[model samples]
Structure formats: C-alpha cells, structure tokens
Target: MASTAHRVCMAMLALPAIALAHGEIVVDVGHTLAAPGATSARGRSEFEFNLDLAREVTAALQARGRSARLINEDGLIPSLKARPQAAEGAAFLLSIHHDSVNAFELQPWQWQGQALDYNDDFAGHSLFVSRDNPDTARSILCARIIGARLQRMGFEPTYKNGRRRAYADPMHAVHYYDGLAVLRHATMPAVLFEAGVIKNRDEELLLRDPARIARMADGIATALVACLTAGQPADDEATADGPPLQPVVE
Candidate 1:
C-alpha cells in the first residue's frame, strides 16, 4: 500500500507547469481617458497607430518564437467590464497611446535657441501590479526595453518642466509608475505608454508612418521577451498610488 501511494505521488509531482510557458503578452491599444472630445479623425488616427504598432510587435515576436497577441480590436477598446477573466493568467498587458495634448509654444526651445512647439504630450510611462506579491517584474522589464528603443529612435522626451530633454543614454524614463484601472484589475503586470505626441506636427507625422509604428511595436515585443527571460515572479503589492490609466502620458 505504501509503494502504491508513493507511485501516485510521483505521478502528480511529474505534471508539467500549467502556466503558459510561452506566455501571452496582451496588448490593449484603445487608450481613452484624458483628451476629452478626442473621438475625431485626428483622435482616431492616433489610436490606430497604437494598434499598428502592437501588430508589428506581435509579428516580430512570432518571428522570434515568442507567442504574443492583441486583446483589443482595431480602433476599439476592449470591454474589460464585460470580460475581466481574459486578463487572468496573461503574462502582461501593454496599453498603448499617442499623447493628445493641446498645442503649446516653447520659448528659446528651453534647451536650444529654436522656437519649439509640440502637440505631443510625451507622457510615456508604465504601471505594474499593486497586489501583494504582484508579479510585475516581467512587465517592468518590458517597459524598460520599449523606453530604451524609443529614446534611441529620437523620440524627444517631454519633461515635467515642459521642456524636451535630451534622451539620457541608458536611462530613459520611458518607464514610470501608475496605478491605473488596467493595472489594478489586471491579474498580471500591466503598463501604458504614450508612444509619442500625435498632435505635434513632427510627432503626428511620425505616428502616421507605418515604418515608425512597426519599429515601436518591434521594440515592445523585444522588451517583453527580455522580461520573460528573467526568472522572477511579480513582487509584493506596492503601497504607492500609481498614476491613472485614462489620462495616459502625453
């Protein structure tokens, strides 16, 4: 009887990990919060770019054997309230946005002698899990990767001083803290990044380009992959209040 029981225990112990080893990084591109009356063509365009970027990232990841998917549809935000369970067990949730701030003029361009104006909010940031033992390290890793790539690609950083700061090599603030709705409810670590200012003449131009969107997506996918490579679970829930997800960075 002891031997039989031992055999049963061995069989149970041998079961493979059920956690999606080839984890799914869920992309949510319908970032709607601040920028009221942003449902116009321009607003929609900004949102569409995010979708394209995610698709590009997904394709690149597939090429590299990392499984990824977009939970949101083109030009539509998912009804999270309608289906909260899908977020459960996801490796990560990345909500993408194009900052849609009002246009403003820069004096002396602050850093340079050029007159600068940007409609882009440059509100690039991220938020992780708040739950104790919130497994968010992987998502943070993903944010860092995306930030680094965007910085290198000449995406100007809009500092709190309302100035465009030079991208500090190897230390892009692309990753910041927030406790938005998506972050709070998500069972996995999640983030929301303002890809660029879509309202700024230059940024708006870039956002409209397929190549640029593709590059952004590729960067995100690569970063998420890196986080998965690291073997750490989510950290304990943090006590701080993360920024809201609706207003998005920008």
Candidate 2:
C-alpha cells in the first residue's frame, strides 16, 4: 500500500515538469482595429498584416506541440498600456507588426485612381527589444535566435530608418527600441517583430503571399522552440544592458 502511494506521488510530480517543457507563448497582434498601424503602399492596413502573421505563427507553434495563444481582439480592444498585461505568466511574448518609413520619406502615388502613399526605399524585416524589461537578457537572446533564423531563410533585416536617425541602433540585426511600451512592461521575455517594410510596393506584394508568411512563421517557431528548450539563465546571471548599438547606415 505504501509503495502504491509513493508511485502515485512521483507520477504527479513528473507531470508538471513535462508540461513545462512545452511552455506557453503569447503571440500578440500589434495595434487595434480603430487605430490600425502603418498603411501599405497598396493601401492595406498594418493591422491586417499583423493579424495574419500572428495567426500563422500561432498555428506553426501549435503544430510543433507548443502551447501558443494569439491575443486577438474583436474591435478597438486593449490599449498599448494594457496589452502587456495579457502576457502575464507566459514564457515569452512576441508582438507582430509591419514596418513603414517616416512621413518625409513618403512619395505621392496613385492606386485605383486614388492618391496613395509609398516608400520603396527600404525593404527588409527588423527585430526589437527593450532595456527596461525585467528579463532583458532572455529577450535579447530570443531576438538573436529569431533574427538568425530569419536570415538563414534568406530574409533580410531592415536597417533603414528613413529620416529618423536616432532609430539606427542595430546589434546583430536586432534594434534596441527601449521606449516601446509593450516590451518595456511585459513581465516575461518579449520581442517586437517588424516582419517587413509594407510601404515598399514590392515588399507589400511579398507580405501578401501566403507561402512567404508561412516560411517566416516557420522560422519564428523554430527559433522560439530552440530558445525555450535551452532554458533561460538565472535572473542574477542575466543583465539588462544589451550589446552596443552601431551607427546607422543608409
């Protein structure tokens, strides 16, 4: 009878560790419907791009046996300040967004007989992390792994900042965007992914491609699984100070 009780206790203790192996990841869809982010060269909203990619990434992670959730809202849901709160207890949080240049870089154009904006100058993806996050080291590590995977899949990392010269701090293709509220406030390791420059006509078409999005999703999932499985360092061992930012190149 004692042996049976001991065996049951051991089984219960082992279940949680096994569950921990497949950690929960929150896939945040950037921006809200009422305030959708950057408009594409072809007239698509950044929110559309963010939602599609977030869904794809969630699917990819689930297919790999990982627990992933998409923080999707029906309408003008949560504000930026409240978004990070949804990620509490998650092992990692990834905010998906599409990139665009400043107003000064926008060029006048016509699409379907309507005046449109376009900026084809820069064409690539970018990753960001915040210095204020409690788990900055893990955040940086996760970004590096994701950036490396994206590079391996033949996707380029965007370094172009349009007219904003201060935005040019690149370290291993990951930029330090410390002011971002989502990354700064999230309790767990976080990363903001600018999948690509949607304002570029050619890149807009690429972002719309289902195959391209799937490939990108695969790369992200691969990196995430790798990072989680490798395990994060002890809080004391990791530091908030990230790598030195290099000069911005045109």
Which candidate number maximizes lDDT? 2
- Candidate 1 lDDT at 132 equals 15
Candidate 1 lDDT over 7-31, as tens digits, reads: 3443342212234346676666554
* Per-residue alpha-carbon lDDT of candidate 2 for residues 1-250, written as tens digits (9 for 90 to 100): 1244443442342213333356698899998888898989888899999999999999999999899988954536567867778877777889999999988989999999878899888999888877556666667777888888889889988777423323323544676776688887787778899999998999999999999999999999999888777746444224344432433211
How far off is model 1, as Cα RMSD?
10.3
Task: Candidate 1: list runs displaced more than 4 Å.
Answer: 1-21, 32-44, 74-84, 102-133, 153-156, 160-170, 174-177, 231-250
Q: What's each prediction's clash count?
A: 15, 0
TM-score of structure candidate 1: 0.63
Candidate 1 clashes: the total is 15
Give the Cα lDDT of each candidate. 0.50, 0.77
| Model 2 misplaced regions, further than 4 Å | 1-21, 73-75, 162-171, 231-237, 242-250
TM-scores of all predicted structures: 0.63, 0.83
| lDDT accuracy of residue 226 in candidate 1 | 64
As for candidate 2, its clashing pairs are none
